[model samples]
Every structure is written in structure tokens, then in C-alpha cells.
Target: MRDADTPRQEPTDDRSHPAALTPQQRADLIRAAAAEVRERVQAWRDNPNWRNTPANSHRYETTLGAIGVLSELPEPQTEEALASLADAVRPIVVEWRPSRPGPEQSIYAAVERLWRTIDVHT
Candidate 1:
């Protein structure tokens, strides 16, 4: 069952849609998202308790690896150039959730905002 208030999920077919962006636009969106993620991860690492929890530490490392891959691109990519990247990376964004409610709200909120922006921009 579905509710009228629920937002419709965007179709996954990158090639068939009229709203589809050009290769350059997709690349720009990817770069922007990657930059935002990197900045957030850096702030997380700066927290004194970030390394105290093994799970948190592992998450930080995984985020670092993802950022590294994004940063290593020889040049900015095009929309077609980024389709594979988007497919490979979307799952990671989908899997993220805020672990707690207070300060964690910012991270989760940012994730949601970023997700929406990427969805539309890409």
C-alpha cells in the first residue's frame, strides 16, 4: 500500500528520462556530494569520542575510503561517465541513517538534504 503523501521514487534508468542531465552535470553533482561527505567525515573525526567506539571508527574509515576514491578521479566526469559511479554509490547513501536523535540529527538531516539534492541534480 502507498500513501498520497509519500514521494515517488525516481526511476533508476539513467538513459531513458527527459529530466536526465548531461554527463557534465552528473559529474558536477557527484563532485559536490563527495565534497560535502568529506567535510562531514572530517568533522566526525575531530570529535574526541569518534575513535572511542570501534563501530564509529570503522565507519569513519569506510567513509575515508569512499572519499579517497571520489577524489582520485583524473578529471571531472560527464553524466554518462558518472552513471556507473552513481549506480555503485547510491546504495551507500541509501544505507546511512542517524544513530541517535540529538546531535546525530544534524548528520541524518544533512544526509536527507544531500540525498534529495543529488536525486534531482543528477
Candidate 2:
């Protein structure tokens, strides 16, 4: 029965989305997600053959989708923290060959955005 201009109400359940997160909780989520990105990038880099494979592409896509959400975390970033992440990803950039933007490029892109977001906010 409310008019369209009425401000929408947030869920009072305290379990809804970002509202459920305290600053510490949100920071922890960001840390965890960044860690996952670092780990996945290392996993791919360590096993170079997996970069452009057929069977693994699906899995990479799913992981990238998750990383995309992590990259979108709504928080101001600390550059020192983000710098290590960018450094973790630096080697990935070194290995990239320009053909098209596929799995490796997508992974690279997400981490690139992640660090850049963190840097910009800092």
C-alpha cells in the first residue's frame, strides 16, 4: 500500500546481505575473497599447462564469477593490503599472451580490478 517514493525498508532480521556485516565482518569477507583470488592465480600459474585447457574452463568461469563478486565489495581499501595482492598477481600478467580475453585474461582482469579498486579507495 506504500507509495513508490516511500523509502524501502531494510530487513530487520539482521541476517540480510550487507546489513548483516559489521565493519570487521565485511573486512574479513574482503580479506578472504582476496586470498581466494591469490590462491587461484597461483594454482593456475604453477601449472602453466592448465591455462588454455578445455575441461577446466568451466571451473575457471565459476571461480571468476565468484571473484567478480568479491571485487565488488563495498568498502574503502587499504593500499598496502592491496599492493601485496597486486604483487601476487604480477607474474600472471607477465605470462599473458595476447590472443583473446579468455580464462587467463578474465582471471587477470578480476585481480587487476581488485587491486585497482583497493588503490583508488585508499
Candidate 3:
């Protein structure tokens, strides 16, 4: 028997989602990602065409998908999803290069830096 107003709860697998970590980890990820990207704003401004490159384009979209989930989901619980996202983005970031000026590389570099924190802490 259940109350009509009770929210439906899905059974969560134990291992697929690790035990929730401290919320500080979540805050740190968001902070680091923001700082990394913001610091490279000038580079992005200088080489606006980097977005057109295939590697950068793919990297950018993958990063956004990770961030989308991170931003939308609750913290601690978001850790597993974040780790999966980081793992997926790693290869792309590793292979990415600047198609424009060297400064343009900072965009993906920033992304890599952000992803590292997620990798290291998790």
C-alpha cells in the first residue's frame, strides 16, 4: 500500500552508483570548470574559429553534456555520472589540438583540467 502523494522511487543499483561523496567534491568541480573556461575566454576570443575544428567541436559537445548533467542533477549522487562523463571525454581531449592560433588550445585545455579534478577525486 502507498499514499497517492508519495513520489515514485526507483530502485537504485548499489555498485553502479558508488556511495555519495562529500558535497565539497561537487562544488569543487563546478568551481574548477568555471575558472578554467573563464581564464581561457581571451584565447577563445582571439581564435573564434577553433569551434569549427572537428576535434574541438566534439570535445566541446562532450564537455557540455557532462556539464549539463552535473548542473542538473543533485550533488554527491552526481559523482558516478560525472566520472563516466570524464572517462568518455578523456580520449577526445587528449587528441584535440588547436586548428587556429596556439592560444585557442586553451579552451580544450581548460576542459581537460576540469575533467582531471573529477578523475582524481572520484
Candidate 4:
């Protein structure tokens, strides 16, 4: 048995939970997420270390696509989809590092973190 102080893990059933959001709500969530993403992207762009790295640019593009998909998803399904999308993008981010010559760090990880944070609040 778990201790009382332990946090409860919410049950997740995609069918029931994901299907609960209305279309408008989903769109709103997407917009909010996109705004956050844009801010992060701008930060990345402003970073001198990130400017010259081609890998970072590619990662940024991939994140943009993911954000688009997130925006298009049905409201109810957004949570599950975002979680899955974050997972999918994590590896790409991890493989990218600024130190590597050809394949430096990508924005994937940062994006994933952003998605996860959004998922929690929404």
C-alpha cells in the first residue's frame, strides 16, 4: 500500500478522458501551448550558442510541426496526444548536443518539457 503523503496518480483512459474536451477548448489549449512554444523558440533564436547550430534549427522545425499537430487535435484527446508526442520527440532532442559537430542538441527535449508542463495544467 502507498503512504498517505504519496501523490495520487490520475487514471488515464484515452477513450474517456481524451474524448471529453470540446473542440473550442482544444483550440484554446493549442493556442496557449503555441504561444509558450514561440517564446521558447525566440529564446533559442537569441542564444548565440544556438544560432550557428544547424541541428538546433532542425529541432525547432520538428517542434513547430508537433505544435501544429497539437493544435489540430480534438480537445479531449489533446492530453494523451501531447504526452505521446512529447515522448516521440524526446529522443530527437536527446541526440542533439551543441558540442557535437554534425548532430548537436535539438530543441526536442525543451519542447517535450514544455508539452509535459502544459499537459499537467490543462
lDDT of 3 at 9: 61
* Candidate 3 lDDT by residue in tens digits, 1-122: 66999775634434322224454554555455645654464455446464566755665555455455545544334556555545544544554454454655566666565554555644
Best by lDDT: 1
lDDT digits (tens) for residues 31-110 of candidate 4: 55455655666666777666655865776676566656654554445455545544443433444344533223233334
- The ten-residue window of minimal lDDT in model 3 covers 10-19
Least lDDT summed over 10 consecutive residues: which range in candidate 1?
10-19
Pairs in clash, predicted candidate 1: 23-78, 23-79
TM-scores of the candidates in the order shown: 0.62, 0.33, 0.46, 0.41
Q: Rank the candidates by lDDT, best first.
A: 1, 3, 4, 2
Compared with the true structure, what per-residue lDDT tens digits does model 2 show for residues 1-122? 66999876533433335324454444554455456555656576566466666634654554554555445644435544444443443433344333345445655654554443344323
* TM-score, cand. 3: 0.46
The weakest ten consecutive residues by lDDT in model 2 span 10-19
The clash count of every prediction, one per candidate, is 2, 0, 0, 6
Which 10 residues in a row give candidate 4 its minimum summed lDDT? 100-109
Q: What is the alpha-carbon RMSD of candidate 2 to the true structure?
A: 11.3
Among residues 3 or more apart in sequence or in different chains, the pairs in candidate 2 whose N, CA or C atoms overlap within 3 Å are none
Which residue ranges in model 2 land beyond 4 Å of their true spot? 1-15, 50-122
| TM accuracy, model 4 | 0.41
